[model samples]
Target: MSGGADLPGAAHLVLADGVAHLDLETAVFNAMLEGWARQQATRFLSSDGTIQPRISLVRRFASFTNEYPWQWDSADVEEFINHLRARRPSFAVSTGRGYQNILRLFCEYVTDARYGWPRKCYEHFGEAPVQILHEWNTVTHSSDYEGSPGRRPLTYDEVQGLFDAADGRVEEIRKRRRKGALAAMRDSILLKSVYAYGLRRREAAGLDVADLRRNARMPDYGRFGALFVRYGKSSKGGPPKRRTVLTVPEFDWIVDALDQYVDEVRPLFQPGKHPALWITERRGRISLRRVDEAFETARKVAGIPEELDLHCLRHSYVTHLLEFDYPERFVQDQVGHEYASTTAIYSGVSDEYRNRLLHRSLKGRHSALWGHCFD
Candidate 1:
């Protein structure tokens, strides 16, 4: 009502208080999304997986509060987060923190002056968007590792049971002349591969035949001597990191397993041109979901605890390698950790391992004190 000139957009009919019409409010919202899309794109994030989720979170927050970003305040964030916490199967600390961080990033993007979202909001709504969520109002980072306390590395017996269960499933299917015998066999090897190499689910799913490499020192093992992991976890805006994990002596039996699967069984999948190491029955590459499903099936058969997951295999790998007296830095590099501390956090070494370390220290101290040495 105060403006003299008629604007071209749908919200040209402005109120005396300078608040935007509904259509203009919608348009500003769309523009905010567009700006966020460009920002994420510039940083090389996937539109569907990364940017869209953030957009949906903002939309869900707005729906919860019945308030647009321009009207949101710290209290709204607090209430919505509280609601999340109160819901059944409440968000874990890590998950809650992730959602809080996503909201904070969106607020930062919208309020940044260079993006012009704040300026446009002010012109249309008589107020600009503000950074509503702050550290005081949201979850704070307390530790590098904040996963469930119940989640832990599988012990040696548990790992052995899991592998035996997987192998047993393959035999059972084959005995019954079932259609899934080959698939079951593949799953058996897949789960072992995940633990043998300390692979994340995605990394195992993304493997290709060519990713298997020969180590000159371990030529007897041939192509199964090392794994070239091209899908190691990425940084915030970076492509997946790459690493070559040499076959450790403890898990060397994996070489025979891989040789059998690759030479004899993989061709049965009829994956002609597909180079993926793990092929589905449909002759396509295995997905990350399938990797988890395989691990879960084996876990249940092995009677492992329900809380343990595919990731626990990786944890088991780290812990077991340490138990074997492998150098800490060697284990870190094998797992493709960016820092030694990150590798350290994954370690949940068994009590037996600690006891062995204590015994070794006592024996060494006795050797220093006495004339004779004990083996």
Candidate 2:
């Protein structure tokens, strides 16, 4: 069982176990290893249906078998990472990070306890990968993207414009309710609430119409409460909390949409079942795939030609909250992000803003009569 000699691979496991086992490529092996570790050590597991991501990480790192501990030296890692960079897949940094991270796990799983981080490892992955992750800045990592300069928040006017446009879309779509778009509008309102009031996507998608009902939790989440989604990607292991800032009018729109879908639409869609708030027309409860497609359809309808997905709604939430003068920690709380408050995202200043501050510092420096040291 030492040094990957007994590591289970499809080609070899059945040789001893007498059953044809699923193939475990290096990436897949790492995934199962980590999942075992988490269960044994931390009780950590993703919500139902986490296999897709595990599979995705596997397929992306398929060639790791060739990068043996010895062959994948400093230069090999550098070349591999550079090759990954050139491909520039939307998730390139992620893919490269994935490759290294998974391989690191593999080394942990298979390497003898006696042989530690290779002398070459420090030279190649300096400061250790963990430290690099602790200090990495996404902006610097992605500086090569075309026109990905520090994107500023939309002005108040633009914010209002987005709201107005969303509202207009709702009104127009209202006329076409026969198209079963009440579900679409319901989802749009949910997305808008998340963007405007800062609901995490999973929480938003997980909302039950019942969750928003006054006295729904029997005075626990409180009347006129926002539903808290806590178990998914955004907030892991923490008790969920509702937003206290939603205005009655703003909250009402989401409530109205949910009500319409449940009373008129949901019955037509589902004769007698409702486990989740976002239900499909026929199935009673919508899957994550259905929720995502709803978002995609609405994005196209709203004329946002670019890749406007859930994460953009989240980014929009964070950026707009900053413009609205919400404090760094407060916005972080709303979004359920742990490290973002200290990291650049919380109070991340734009380079342009930093330069402007530098200019102001110059003015202060020269404000003294001779530009000498201030008394």
Candidate 3:
């Protein structure tokens, strides 16, 4: 068949015209993946970050079944999911659901008449791919927040302890006349900035010096009044989202910390016109792994639980903003959440805040019931 414009995924375009190959089945399978990748890239505008993992997962499923997509069935999907669930450190419910969704999408693509994959497979192997994932066999999205319960917002004291530990590391290194004192100081400021701006790890790591913006209203904060986040998390099939995270009065301490880091400490790295806000010892932009390492080192020193991660700083930011009486919509916008429910999910307001809220509600509704009890 000639490659045609109307054919989805350009299945015929990817398959060799007249090549003699020893392993025809493998070649066909690779061609299917290549065609799928092209469809995702050209038609759907999917990034490599989104396409590569999907291709890898499809290959893994093929390996697990020891058969091609045409041979896959509901039973294979069930068994594969079970195998994943039974592994040590078992996959989370959301992760399993995501896997099922990807597999379902792939199956849909291959089985569709417009894709030409079904006919191609039938012509070659007398079998065609079928959708294997069904509601009964696949993991269901039963909860809004399926992330680990252990991953919660840190208490104010815990956040303080973590920052103190990071600062203490800088002192320890400086006293010993050791290397990494600058790095330790940078990490301290980085951790605080993550909380101050409610940033994801990538958002924090992706920051440039120019991302620090001046707010006309918050003139006191100077260049640290807001953060122009260029690498905000993207929706599926979209480029990185952008947002401006404004500085609030509660987290204004970050202004001085950032001012010091940008003006003095960051220069020690000799970045030589490097634009990255977080520079490494090598005068390169810091990586996400290094950000994690910085958090982990301080977490251990601060004696925080292992379950709490770098992301917890973000959670803490949301929770604290709510505690500080910020409007829900304001918090949602600050964190770049598309929905207020997502902001609520990240927030774990303190018992004290909840009690105060309850007290205020009761006082407002039943003024006589309180009888000056709150006072």
Candidate 4:
């Protein structure tokens, strides 16, 4: 509240609508948001640089409600989030964040209602109770939002079953006389690459055939061999990042797909040049959408509806790796995450692991030394 944080600013009372219209002092609003954004940098959009863009989002909502003075009182914060989720066509976690980031900006600036700001904000968008809304509303959150259910990774058997089913299901598509034979091949490679490595869709789609290979410079695959992974979309701040993930199956499968596309199918496209690893035969280029649809169709054919989407593949991959007891550092790097905590959610794969560390320690060696309880 240092920079005009306490000022009520200019106010116009809207008596009938039960809300006040406070004209925010531009400087005060800017400073407030600037501070708040910095305070919540871990939230992704909390950086100082995010202030203006975040403000734009808040203003956009203000344009519609143009009701003036977005008080936190007339409505609840959580209600506003819910309304946003409902109004938007898709309520993916990413979308929910659009609203949260804006509101967080508001929270930084406006601490009180020139009148009903808090009530209105709460009424329209109920207090999230949790920073990131969970699956119940619209899947959005980084570290398990309080009360917001999060995704858990699938077991090795489950991931293996999905991959196995995909292999068997390819023959089904071929039997049905599917037109895109290359599409079928694409599906196999996509699943193998994503699930085997727990890759984000962007990283997978963003690849180029030239990206994979042994380089004496980086030696990402080590001196003996090479593999490539360009992590185009990152969960952490800043622009998409670049990292080289070296894995034999991941390298081999992706290389095979590239060969099929360029050596075989890509030649069918009209004369044009593109660098993306995944591209359509239509000439424009293969895209994230084509990859999505291909995955969906393959899932339907395989009949594993519980977990079949791209990220679901990620979930399965992470869980399977955890089950195998891979080092957290290695997993973190492979997943392109900045820290072990970010990837810790995958540890939910088993209570056995937690019990070994938490519960088992309670029993210690000298149980009869004194009165004690597991609590």
Which structure among the candidates has the greatest TM-score?
3
Poorest 10 consecutive residues by lDDT, candidate 3: 1-10
Which one wins by lDDT: 2 or 3?
A: 3
* List of clashing residue pairs for candidate 3: none
Ranking by lDDT: 3, 1, 4, 2
Candidate 2, residues 158-233, lDDT tens digits: the string is 4444555555666777787656555655555555566654555566666665565454443332444455454334
> lDDT of all the models against the reference?
0.86, 0.48, 0.91, 0.55
lDDT of 3 by residue, 11-87 (tens): 76788557876898898899888878888887556555689899999999999999999899999989998888788
Better of 1 and 2 by lDDT: 1
Compare candidates 1 and 4 on lDDT and give the better one: 1
TM-scores for every predicted model: 0.91, 0.59, 0.96, 0.59
Highest lDDT scorer: 3
All-Cα superposition RMSD per candidate:
4.8, 9.3, 1.8, 10.6
Model 3 residue-pair collision total: 0
Alpha-carbon deviation at 357 in model 3, angstroms:
1.0
1-375 in candidate 1: lDDT tens per residue? 332333322112222335555687776776676667666777888777788998888889889999788999889888998898888464798888888899899888777765556656787679988998776877778788988888999989999999999999989988888889899899999999999999999899999999999999988888899999999998878888999999988999999999999999999999999999999999999988889899889999999999999999999999999999999999999999989999999998878889989988888778777626556
